[model samples]
Target: KTAVRVSCGEEHTAVLTKGGAVFTFGSGRYGQLGHNSSQDELRPRLVAELWGAKVTEIACGRFHTLVRTDSMKVYSFGRNDQQQLGRGEDSPPSVPLPVPLQQLCATSGLVIENIFAGGDSSFATCVHKKDLCRRLKNDETPPSVENMVDTWISGCDSKLLKKIKKEIHETFSSASCMNRSFLSQSKDKHFQTSPDYPGLDFSLAQSVFKKLLKKEVLSTEVQAAVVQLLPALDGNPVGVEGLRVFLVLNELLHVIQKLKKQPNTRLAEEVAAAVQKLSPENLQIIDSKVTDVYKRDFFHHLFLRIVSDKPEMFMFNDSETLVWFSSEASEENVVNFYLFGVLCGLALYNNSIVHMSFPLVLFKKLLDVEPTLEDMIEFSEAVGGSLKYILDYEDDDLEDQDFTFKIHWDGMDVDLDPQDPQKAVTSQNKKQFIDAYVNYAFNTSVEKVFQEFQRGFFQVCDQRLLKLFHPHELQGMLVGEAVYDWEVLRQ
Candidate 1:
């Protein structure tokens, strides 16, 4: 005998003999026994109707029953509440009936893959012969098949049809009649209702359904409601909360796009103001702790826009923010990054006068150490090398200017009368200062200091920018050349 244990909230066991006989034991609250009446049979009871047909599988819902025949037909009984029995009603069946599921099966000539019965619902998967063949051809596990003959038989019964339809309407209408106050009052009620069975909160589900129905009943009215709610979406924590930030960002982008086309002056002004109020710096600080991809995308777009429009804001900030932005700016976040980059480029160019002191200070700090000199030289060389490629390109403006020159350094800390500051400070001068400073303090060769500079520049500058520096100039300084090669230097 092949025995199967079943669980319908609690445990029960059923056994099937090789000769096709079936027996069951356990909880029987409804007529789930397939033998009539609500009886809790503790011992295995032979199911008489299933005597001739070979029982292949048995499934138990909270208060319903399902049995599969060897020929792939299925039989069901007990509770039909929620149309879970696939028989279309909320009443319990007194006897086991064959279910009519032939239409579902005839659509694809497939057998049943499996059957799953939840507390108030049942689902089945059918595996078509062609699909199975394809799986087998690909060395995949082909789904075992069973025909849903039971569903078709049960559905064909006139009495069952009326019961199913009436039950559905009653369950829906009764749920609709119960308002929030009524539900709250019935919260402690012990009797199991069809819609609220298993004690799940159906308030949200009911609301969603009513909203859907309302939308169908009055399309124009619902559209006006949507328009009214559109402005409030930003404030709707329940509506927008727990949603991916990416979705919000996408919606924001769509709004921006639409504004570009239609030009909603008031909405545009409001959105722009809202964006400005929501500072990117604050958003970045908040985004760092978040691991959600959608939220990250949202914050990423916001951060990019802020930085691009106000590059000066990020110029003096820590590199962590830049790294974070770079990491999150994928194809999904590209629009944000592209807009941001454009903004940053424009900001950098437009605000040159105001930012002159800052970049100069950054450059000075970088050259202050012996290692910084090597890094700067390497960076400059990379920049020069990339310029070489551009200079070689056809129809380019760069070819009109002198492309090569040598940079010389007389000494460090030249006493300029502040009014007579030199045109520019060279890498050699910076290196000399770093060597002298380190030697006087730590007694180490400037080479070690130069190495540190290389690491620092790579850390600070974007990889694309670093690749633009000339390498020959860097190599000349490293080899102790008094005058570094500037053949490729821009005049």
Candidate 2:
């Protein structure tokens, strides 16, 4: 048989064949040979116990062997005095046996990708999948909020309840939960449970979340509970809870939006303040060491969900936080590029939703803040080069083409100085405040933002924004050269 993979212990060897079989040889002092007795194998011996399963990978310890199957099942044999094979029991098995880690992995919400072992210790790297897909694959019914509450109560201790209450109290009393430097951390430092509250399981926490999403519950109480419970999410040893966290955060967002209209102004503001803290910078923290495809895609889907489900939230609130990383600052942490990629991806994926909103301004600010052509190109590639198309276009030869521009000056004072030191308009600061106001007007003679770009008044933009344009709609920049010059004169 063709050997696909091979690993060796201190005095034994294990080989994975292309046909999904394992062959063992050499020392059997600790049952490492996988035979029925502690006898050395002079020749390659097929691991008969694993005859039905196809072994995809293999790892050998000092006196034990670990193998992973094509179906993600893991098995082990040999020395178990140190529990190196991960069987829990101290007895060594003379034949290859399944590791039985599926239950633990499932509870933690991770897909086992690979097995690792050495020096009497072993590990299994896990990946995170989209929560919705995982639930479907597992055939789990979406438990009702009442059911979830009962489940939480049944599984958790009094300490967890007290902790949850304490978190709520602290959150409402705190001025704000927004962390300005969230993107600057070199390690995974997002929401986490306090060390004192031990044995908090993902299932129990998820049930609490489902219960909070129900309309029958008091919004304030649920809001407080969510804020308090967020930290416990940090307890994810495997990345399975990545999807759970995403869902929790999204549900909490809806709660905040509803709370904004409630009568309790103090509680509403507290909830809003806490909501603001859940920016891409904070929530998108990923462990660099994790190489699991599911875990990575989990975050990717989370970003997409935020942009697609709540475009305005990302455009007005989370998009503004991109300024936390200058091109230089981004180099200090990979999360900068990762979050930016999400923003770019957001614009690309939800181009129609964000086109009339603040997305273009976000692109402009990112181009300006990005320190290098490489980073700029990376940002551009993230959005499929639509950004570059917007930045570089010729409108001079388009005089014959009909164009319109729309600028919202609804709240601006005509006399405000654009050049005043106290009112100085930084490029990003301008984009941050004005982009939302910069929108397409759906009228016969409506002005367009692109005309300003053609006239060398507004920055250049491409036809991507035109995706929002109607057949009768005008296509031009919102600000005109005359208006721009007038503003300069007024300043």
Candidate 3:
């Protein structure tokens, strides 16, 4: 509940937590407090609407507030007569709502990097994109935030949408270039031939599609326009058109996966049907390269959400599809890059122990596929050893909620001299990199997070399996004294 930072509006104040939670207090008139009410709060109160979100920063205008989440989403609530909220709505918002930076983000693929407010107007900024710099040139007017929503909703930019649709159509209509586009690197303009799948901008389509979705500009007309074109690529598994269709569907699945609510079943079915249309040969290609398709700016958001404890962000419920994917990936051969991503996520999100249900057999196979030593030891400690020692056969009713672990990181020993010209990567630099990596994985307390994952593992696994971990091994894991090989831990 500690506030890492606090901001004050004209009369209201908002606080952001070390844990990324948001709380607000003071006046709420004009909805500046972001709690969806105009009444003043005498003390700090949680903004329930943003419960699952991790807010990183907050900015307040004279009579409004703008908060940015770690996920790059910005929300505003308060006075907006000047349209400072950046929303399309005519009236002020009483609750925190997402601000549409869709147009700006579509061009830059950057988050709201900074925000500033004036007496009557609000300004937000995104990371400058090199491509935008090249495209805008020296003569264009400076960008303005006015009328964004109006322009978006009224389709004032319908030509752009049509252009995108046409590009999709033409790309997929050709039979020669389908699979190549999906795996092609971004192309230099001078060397590029086809504009649709221009030199390695595969992620451009992904970002554009996501930007369109975020803007609330996606229309039924647009969806139908894209989906209706799919039939033309039938039987031509490697056709250029089929690749285009898959790209759109893949981005849609990513978007739908991030929704906190029940998915749009109709859209899901449409996407599923499209996936089903891929012949077995084509399906193998997709299965092999699925991870590559997901490596855009949206990957972090999608990975963080899907690997969450409750894990409902994505539905891979098609058993037949799962079988296909699994067949292409194994200990001797790995097809999907996401399999390792999932394992890394499991290690990071503390789901490492759940793999114990397969009796460590599946976990062993994964280790062979990618012998990332650090990940394996972290996973082993998380799933196997640490929890049994801590819990020690407690009854179901025995709650040890008060137990906590205090962790500390010792600095590394580096003897290399930085002044030596021959030593580009000094020992100190290597140590720094290693420490930084470990800190990122474990956050502040490496020991505490490691123990917590172990606790979670114990909470999930059967009591009988506690015997699988030897006492000495459990002690070694808990004290951070173990050296586990990626090859040996699974055994």
Give the TM-scores of the predictions, in the order they appear.
0.26, 0.30, 0.26
Candidate 3, residue 162: lDDT: 64
lDDT of 1 by residue, 96-118 (tens): 77777756797769877567677
Worst-scoring 10-residue span by lDDT in model 2: 440-449
Better of 2 and 3 by TM-score: 2
Error of 1 at 301 (Å): 70
Q: Encode model 3's per-residue lDDT on 1-491: one tens digit a residue.
A: 55678887778888888788888888887988777789999999898988999988888888888888877788888888888888976654878888877556866565456676676677877765664456558657622212332344456356777654454444434433333443433333313323243223445445544544554334344455445654555644434334544654565556655632554445545444454445444544443344443333223333333233222212221221110012112332221223323333333223222211111212322222222334323434442233333334344432233222221222223222334423332222433433333343333322332233334333333434535655433333222233459788677
Please give the TM-score that candidate 3 achieves against the real structure. 0.26
* TM-score, cand. 1 vs. native: 0.26
Which regions of candidate 2 are displaced past 4 Å?
Answer: 1-62, 65-221, 229-241, 255-260, 263-338, 351-491
Candidate 2 has what TM-score?
0.30
- Residue pairs with colliding backbones in model 3 are 36-94, 172-241, 178-240, 185-200, 186-199, 186-200, 187-199, 187-200
Which stretches of model 1 miss by more than 4 angstroms?
Answer: 4-13, 17-20, 88-92, 133-491
Which candidate has the highest TM-score of all?
2
Candidate 3 at residue 205, lDDT?
A: 44
Candidate 2 per-residue lDDT over residues 1-491, each given as its tens digit: 75668898899998887688999999998888788689999889998888888788899888988888877788888888877777757444786777888777888777777788877888888776475456558997544434545644443444466554454344422323212111112223232422221112323333444444443333455565545554443333344323233333433444443434443333333333332234343333322221232232333344444344333222122233221112112222333234334433433322222222222333333233212233333323432243243334354433233211222222222223334424433332433222222221111111222222122211122345644543212211321111236776788
Give residue 266's lDDT in candidate 3 (0 to 100): 51
